[model samples]
Target chain A: MRSLKKKERDKLIGDFRSGSVAALARLLSLCESESRSRRDLMSSIYPVENQPFVLGITGPAGAGKSSLINRLLFVFRKRFERIAVLAFDPTSKLTGGAFLGDRVRMAEHIKDEGVYIRSMADQGRAGGVGAGIHDTIGLLSAFGFEMVIVETVGTGQSESDVRLIADLVLVVLTPGFGDEIQAMKAGILELGDLFAVNKADQPDAERTETEIKASLALGRSQTAEAPPVFATVATQGRGVVELAGCLLEKYQELGREGVIDARRSKRVEAHVEEMLKEHCAMLVASEIKAFRTKRAKAAGRINPYRLAGALISKIFKAENNAKKD
Target chain B: MGKIRVVVAKLGLDGHDRGARVISRFLRDAGMEVIYTGIRQSPEDVCRVALHEDADLIGVSILSGAHNALVPRLIAELERSALDIPVVVGGIVPDDDIDFLRSKGVRAVFTPGTPVEEIVKTVNAIVEEKRAG
Candidate 1:
């Protein structure tokens, strides 16, 4: 019951929309809490629609996503004053906790009032992006950030989830990776709107770039423009400015072609579907709990499949009757 | 639905992180959302993060014995910033300083060998009371 009251939470969101960083933090915490009021706060803030250009960075672990993000921030900050980052780290399977080391990696911008960096635990989401990420992005956009950069947990395969949420996705790679090309074929290659071979100072950098180019040439999207791959040494800040420019240019091109709008429209549709499914699941869960309490021995005696059908019909019937009244 | 938000931070120059990491895992297993700030964070950094995260409680792990200096400053900074979240300290504090820490508004202190389950239960009780009021 550590939830903020509705009125107070709404006031906090109002303050957040008016440029209160602390209020923004409070709102994000609420969003992460999985509370009912999280939806209320989101609805109240939804009307203040300032959509920031969302850029997602994801790759295999140790691909230097955080380092590149730090460099990208330096590049993006020159043009945009207010930027926010949502960096996700993998949650411990046994403990469900996470060590969000990205803040330390992006420490250069920690003291800057213009930058809001938040670390999120992935919570074992099948996709790299956690469930709370979508709402957090909405909140950040509503809070008036010019650009919101999301760094997903650098898991190899399911990282493609970034495409569902981001306007542009950059899949980072490093030269010395053991399975370089093989790993790319593991389904991450197709998700990149753009690619960056970080640590370009390494010995096999050129080979990695060439292999990526070959892969892209073969698997380029037919419906969309081919994504460009850039060579970057993120630690030394090499080729990042050009990469950032290319990303922005691609975003603008997508926006012009209405692709950005189409993606966003699809995202909202998915969000609504997800919410509806969650609501239905909640109703089912409550019904099951009530049934269990009413007939505790029924769990051992009855077939779950049959019981579920009966309970679902009863729940829907009750809902429809209430609606008709 | 009101999942507890805990900020686990390391203050001062303590480099040891095993204890902090363990506590974070325990808190997470107990169904709290734990946001861990990595090693060598300043008091101001902890307070700022807690404010942004809207943490219900903060747990600081300091093995550098800077408890007397750093923990007090952290509490004062949280007070100064008007963030009302409770603070909990862990790590290598001497027994003599335990009462002093509690007196200065620390909700609890988990010294070496404190049970993880106890930590979880105590944190839940503290947050439950605060939120209920």
Candidate 2:
């Protein structure tokens, strides 16, 4: 994609501020792609005073996460004037491509001007969410959305990064996911601020919920309460309203306890660290590429550990020389 | 920088979405992000999705012979919303309606038997042109 000129960027920002959904969409695309103007766009919208409430929904594949969100949108739309959903699907590791079909489940809200649903490709980024997701959320908040829901790519046990980004993280599980022992294994179970046993009409739904509650109860003696779990049939809209209510109530409680502010600060710290790491990784990758080419003629069984040390010293030496110059 | 984003939609009452799904996979295999809107989408729904996705192009697969009615409505809706995204039509479009669809602002039309490579190439060229312009 071509980088936008200053004038065009300014116009796009102006349009975005003035409630142009097209401009918001364009800016989001710019963020998702590695456009040169992405930093400029992000910097222009940083420190958004009216950041929307971010709700994250994560679960394993076929857990009815999309269907739940589809129902949740109806409930959220009634309360918030404008709501945006960022639904994520994994990118094919082999092809670096994605078929984002999340919107298909949420199709009922397509024509509602109050609702903006965007399907995101994970773009090979691990930890559930996609690259540039933070920037995407910032842009949506700056666009005057009152709520932004992030539906993570169907995650396994290890992808709990959604807890870092969302003000409230709801982990959706289905019947026969596991027993109490499975819940106690950690990772995803520990990440949820709220839990839902979707597909509640199934025979094992109550048993699954009981196991989750038992595990959560065993884990939480310090806190006054364990995370609440609700049984839901998302397709039928059963138990969704109560789940939505609990979510909003929990968010308010977190805000009252100043937890939200603390979480935001931690998120900012992590974001900076991640950005620095990515930049340094790029530098190291390029340096390695150069080193490989330069040593191509003298191919031998060189120790990788020694080469790594040499590469670091070379980078530091270059840095010092550049500073001196 | 960014991968080309395309919205492949099945417009109208057409439930025959085999072509749309195949094209979606083809686009994905070619290293583009493809959002398949599924079947039974209205023109407005397609336009809204394209706008929200900031899609570079829209490929509408109409196997129900509703191309003449639905494609123009889609273009009109895109125009109405001030979205400049280009569109292409595929599936069961008769040869005679190809020119008509193009004149109605459809960038390309592929009837049955159009090679997958050709479709991918056409999509890439259109998106590149759009980005360049």
Candidate 3:
């Protein structure tokens, strides 16, 4: 409920501009809190803009997803000025929360001014991408990141929310997780803009590669080039160059094919949905606060404890009464 | 000379999270807000996080043997980016690698069995020293 001072606000934006993670985190926490002032602060911060490339990396567990991201970061840092990663983890089966683990993986680079990482804990709200990842990503973009990586909770491909956040999707797999038809059974197989058979050191990587090509061929739409599969031993830093190359290529192809804009439009739809929920919550909180203020001003008769005891009941009653009318 | 912010990371596939969670908690308890990047991290992502976090301490815990490859690259990335936060590596380090880590400019290479009380004391001392001098 604290209102941010001009100094704190300036310092936060300054730290963010200077690549200060702590300032960014505090700002993010303030932005995340349910407060009227926070909404105001976010609105001011939201208007600033930077176009960051959103990349999604997803796959089944034990598929070397973390390892591949490591290699890609190393290769990517060589080219991009700054990089942000939002690694998603399921908070629960239905209520998965996305946590930022960029700090853990690259702990040594804490001093670098170019990189920023955040973890979003899922709030279990209705509508996908809980708590509005698209808005959060947009906030990061405005704060000055050149590239953003949205890594889905690399377990089941059922979490299609990452697709709403990323411009390109890289679905990873390991060899022998299933037969050739495994790719056809659906999950992450069809969603990828690029396919990678990670753990290339393993015996089954080659087979996974063949399966991806065959399945992709069956998906058959001439408007877009079939997703290409690559083999990678990301832990040892093998095959990352090709994967990065492929991501760049696909980004190009999607932009040309006009689906990039289509996805952008879809992302906007999701963004609006989140904004409405925030607006409703704000509305409810304000109404409650106003009722409290008026009650306090006119406090001549009612006992405090009795009023407190029936608060929840009254709130529920108010809600139900509103619906009935 | 603003307050020094830090991001603590536990890298590689090591699932031993007790120490890290404790450190992050301690750092917060110590009056410095801390961001604890959860387990299974890569070097590049760690570096990216540190930079993004605007940290004064790039603390890492490596229970995995990949410490050799991970720590040095992390330090190197910080150096390359001209964002030199004193790196403190903790976890299962042998006596042999202790000096190597220090020589590589890692401020303090703490290992297992180190008292949490002592770890907190030392980190405060180091950060204080940095702030003073």
Candidate 4:
């Protein structure tokens, strides 16, 4: 394990000159990490870095989400030299099984060198992509992708996370996904930067468009950029290009409005803070047995807070000592 | 410098995280700050966590076939986050996918039955080399 980590770290730094985003992704996958050390190292290595533009696509189940994403990737490939995707798969009710259903739709891009797609199972993620989602994004950004697209589970609760994580969020719907539109009107309707009437080739496409527009009127959003409602047949690849254009336009608008940086930095701060919290908590847990042993040997009034403070200080001192050496 | 910090996260819908949990335990015993992201990680969230923790290596173990799709996209997510941590994949990876993963710049893939000793040694060696840079 130590050797593997060492090898992974060496590869990360050695590639510092070339700065391959792909390498960073590999590192995260191998490490399953959420620590502060390497992230700081990356910041030091590459200063003045800007985060990738994030786009979130969400909606009800069976709303042609996978197909839409596939179509969108095609357009993204044509427009962007670097692109990344995070596809959140539905979790299995029986065993928390996560099947990568998006791969079938995204088969063509699987081999594409410029595009990278990741499928995640929404295993009870309470808030915006579960436990390691933040860490994975960090590894991805460090790798150097310019644009990132995140597709969450086709449900209302999961949509909230996508909205928070992405600079622009697209809420998709189809003709027959009945109360899906009504459900969106409740909260998700307001969260979308773009409303998509997917599978427009199906019957009632026009009616679906009208209903979506009406829902948009009822739904108020923090973004006044006017999230356009577009009709698309994801399977046939219709309107995918238009949707992609709107997505890019929204990205630019977020950049121009300066919301992107603020969001990125804020999320970064939160992400790190959360990781530290987890790290500190685990550190305490890890030391419990040892602490108990040491205390038992001394019987010298072990205050947990004081013990923790001393341990943290020790860590800092050791880090300082390493730097000096 | 400080024993090479590493984080292990189980990403996507692939639940069989046995390898991930086992690896975290191994890395911790080997003297690294190994944090396991429990389960279910979106690429963005994982990246965010990595940036916050400032981890050096982010390990992903996916038994699901989504490795190809998830791995590359995750690499892309890291790019957007301005993070550049090295990544290694573990779990049920097919032989054909190995070359493909490496081409996407994956550091390495520890296929099934890989000795834990090899994992520990390789991690240490890899981190040492990277930290020197």
User: Which docking category, incorrect, acceptable, medium or high, applies to candidate 1?
Assistant: acceptable
Q: Give the candidates in order of lDDT, highest first.
A: 2, 1, 4, 3
Interface RMSD of 2: 1.2
Which candidate wins on lDDT? 2
lDDT tens string, model 4, A152-239? 8776544676655677788888886555456454576777878888889889888878876766665467564456899998988888
Error of 4 at B110 (Å): 21
Candidate maximizing DockQ: 2
Which digits, one per residue and each the tens of the lDDT, describe model 3 over residues A1-325? 1366778777777776785555665566555456556555666665545667888877876677766776788778887888877655443333222223433454434445555556544444322234547656767787677788876654554757777777888888888868876668866775788888888798877777887788888857878567788888877778889889878877878899898878877877877787777676665676679768778676788786776557657666876898899
For model 4, the DockQ equals: 0.04
Query: In model 1, where do residues sit more than 4 Å from their true spots?
Result: A2-5, A33-36, A176-184, A219-225, A285-317, A320-325, B14-19, B29-31, B113-118
Q: Kindly list the per-residue Cα lDDT of model 2 for residues B43-98, writing each as its tens digit.
A: 99999999999898999999888889999999999999889999999889778999
Better of 2 and 3 by TM-score: 2
Error of 4 at A288 (Å): 7.4
In terms of lDDT, the poorest run of 10 residues in model 3 chain A is A91-100
- Two-way DockQ contest, 1 vs 3, winner: 1
Off by over 4 Å in 3: A1-3, A14-22, A92-113, A119-132, A180-182, A219-224, A281-325, B1-51, B54-133
Query: How high is the DockQ of candidate 1?
Result: 0.40
How close is chain B to the truth by TM-score, in each candidate?
0.97, 0.98, 0.88, 0.95
DockQ versus reference, model 3: 0.18
- Runs in model 4 deviating more than 4 A are A1-8, A16-22, A34-48, A90-97, A121-124, A184-186, A219-226, A283-325, B1-133
